[model samples]
Target: MNTQPDAPRHVVATSADADTVLRRLAREGWTARSGFALPDPAWDVAAHRIVLHGRIADDDTETVALAVLAAARGAGVVAVCDPESAAGRALIDDLSRIGAVHRGTDGADPVASLIPEQRALLDRLAAGDTIAAAAAAEFLSLRTANRRIAEARALFGVRTTREAVLAYLRQRQPE
Candidate 1:
């Protein structure tokens, strides 16, 4: 396992998402490879990228992919799937929340910005509960809750939890 704290991260939650991103990247003249395992022998992540596709709920695929990620270090890993599927959504959300810090990119994608638990708390807040109340409902300590709220605020580029909530809502609003 590479065990490096900073690594590039990428994910496409559906085959369609994969197609769209890949097409765009290709248009930008980037090279990519799609597969179930890491590229053999040697691969330059900065120059070449890999996309992993399949149901995460399927037999041990996620586990293996995680192992591969650990070994590959700087390589970009894209999880491609059908986001409409429950498993796909879960995978995307999970990856988004955890992978954001590792992406090494300038700005975070709002959709993948929060972990499910944080999002749940935000949902409660959006429904009009006080921050303390929402934190209590989620069984988080006041300190931990505040930490998560702060993290969410930083992720969304806002100063207050309410602003974060509004930003989240705006992001989710349909165009």
Candidate 2:
């Protein structure tokens, strides 16, 4: 079991809003030892506990992807975003629905047969992008994205995007 005590150093991505939040938290005398890194290390299982609000530029999509990665690594990451903003609302909604990151590779990597589009779709979704948004990011129509998901589901032997996400992460494939 992880015996590391929670450090006062919370994780933050490179963004204006994130900077603002970090300032406030510093003033509040919380996470006084705050630190940062490129997304993967910052969100690693050994990294900080909470991923404060704002997009992670390191994620390429400028979304709260590092936060999702942290959560997937079982860090119990918490994100706070403006409910009025569409992106924030999506994070609030989607984060709640994602399951714990699973452990695979004890079997074949389920994502092995997936086409590049399917992999791209899951990557965006795992980064907290909505399906339509993920679709657009990959230059695919909503219909095509959904079709990719359906096809990927068969390849991964999963029923939903969420399931496919967990399966994909199970391999710890680089972000």
Candidate 3:
């Protein structure tokens, strides 16, 4: 037997009704003393491991979950729900797209690996520059700017440039 001490586990219950989800987690052996209720006053990203459960919908929820996952660093983060449910599947798809939880591919931090030029482009966009204006600032052709934005979107698994920028910023926030 390996005999290594088991790692600490952090759990977050996400649902329209957080209380209900939390209660369910409690029944599954996740006590408040052992885990945490997300969005609660005690919640912190520095926990050793995190397990998010319940339903996730809308951009706000996704954003928060992403932030938490980013804060967890390389520690394990698991989302539990009935995969057959539409909402659950959507959450899984979103998580997979963003590379939040491993799904065969290495879960690398997309924002951290951004090249200098890409970082500059993202900075300009965040500072309220239009794609054309940002490109002009960098002396890049409009086509090149568009390509860069597209690349960012693909890298972050976001559909729009705005979403990519927001995701990057959210991930960059301190825990």
Candidate with the greatest lDDT versus the true structure:
1
> Residue 161 in model 3: shift from native, Å?
0.6
lDDT head-to-head 1 vs 2, winner? 1
Which rank order by TM-score, best down to worst?
Answer: 1, 3, 2
Model 2, global lDDT: 0.51
TM-score for each predicted model, relative to the true structure: 0.50, 0.37, 0.39
Better of 1 and 2 by TM-score: 1
Which pairs of residues clash in candidate 1, taking residues 3 or more apart in a chain or in different chains?
A: 13-81, 14-81
Residue-level lDDT for 121 in candidate 3: 89
Candidate 1 wrongly placed segments (more than 4 Å): 1-16, 19-33, 36-75, 84-90, 93-97, 101-115, 127-132, 141-159, 171-175
Best model number under TM-score: 1
Error of 1 at 12 (Å): 3.2
After superposition of all CA atoms, the RMSD between model 3 and the true structure is 14.3
List candidate 3 segments past 4 Å from native.
1-107, 173-175
Stretches off by above 4 angstroms in model 2 are 1-107
> For each candidate, what is the lDDT?
0.56, 0.51, 0.51
Clashes of each: 2, 0, 0
Error of 3 at 137 (Å): 0.4
